[model samples]
Target: MGKVTAGLTMSLDGFIAGPNDGPDHPLGEGGMRLFDWYTSGDTDYVVPSGGMTFKISSRAAEMLQEVFSSIGAIVTGRRTFDITNGWGGTHPIGEHVPIFVVTHSVPEGWDYEGTPFTFVTDGVESAVEQARAAAGDKNVAVSAASVIQQCLRAGLLDEVHVDLVPVLLGDGVRMFDHLGREHIELERTRIIEDPDVTHLTFRVVR
Candidate 1:
């Protein structure tokens, strides 16, 4: 059996990105404050939901290794993929992992280490179905704010690992925005109090 999940860093003030966001300001003004947790070195591939920073500690690393061990494919929102690939320039995802992108329209050329990119616009379910098929005997990783929120709303996410950094953006983007007035249960929690940042992991139980 396979499962889907999402993990993101957030602030005490509940902001994933700073204000003044746009295509030009991907992270938005002072948005980098949410990324302090990504200093985890070149090892961990930090995926920020709503652009919050969460440090990767030894415990978090071990947990991530455990969870990501069987990963065979990945899915992300268009904006997230664009920003990440644009930053990577050449190699992205650190490996030749199959990726499914959610977008209304396909771009001219989207390449990351020559890996194939598939665009999905039908819905989150359709995207996950394709990703799971491509994933084969491995776990499919969901790595975008909008995608995760959709999955969570659609009751698709199974587990999530997140690291919480110490910073307050005051405003910007948020990962759990569309969750609406529904109450989401907090299944599990792991707190990492490193000097650099405070990391936390949550396993959401639907």
Candidate 2:
């Protein structure tokens, strides 16, 4: 079985997204600052923000590549999937990697020709099971915080990775909200520090 993992780039204040998140503003207001490191050289936002165009450290680059390479399938919430518009109606990750979306309602005339997308309305657990099967020996990663929280609360997540950015959003969609009263123990697995962001990985101790 494939291990279940989740990753999110969050602010120091613990928000995964900023206020007024919408279709036009996917990351939310000022949320793009959290991903500045990953998109340093891109011409789109770099020039306007006046952020320095610096190369990501070798270690960070290697770690990111490894994370992507290890994933065979992805599971994410309906909001996340819809916000990205199914990565513009085709799996942006790749044509081969399968994407399982957890949703209450399936979209009309859903179609992504080159890539495979499975809409699992049953629940997070069902979506995870299908993703794990699709992943085989690789990891099944969830990108959305709601899905991650669901997996964590249900004791289905194996690992949680966070790219901790230095900025604080003050108020927005928090990553660790509404987890109920259950206490989930985590063991530190890995940590890679960079000037812009720190990569932290923790194993959910069951």
Number of the top-ranking candidate, with lDDT as the measure: 2
Q: Which of the numbered candidates is closest to the native, going by highest TM-score?
A: 2
Candidate 1, residue 126: the lDDT equals 92
TM-score of each: 0.79, 0.90
- Candidate 1: give its CA RMSD in angstroms: 4.8
lDDT of each: 0.69, 0.83
Candidate 2 lDDT over residue span 1-206, tens digit each: 77899999999889999988878878898877887877653223222113323357777767766887789899998888877777765554566788899999888756646547888999999999999999999999999999999998899999999999999888778999889987899999999988778899999999
Count of clashing pairs, candidate 2: 0
Count of clashes, each model: 2, 0
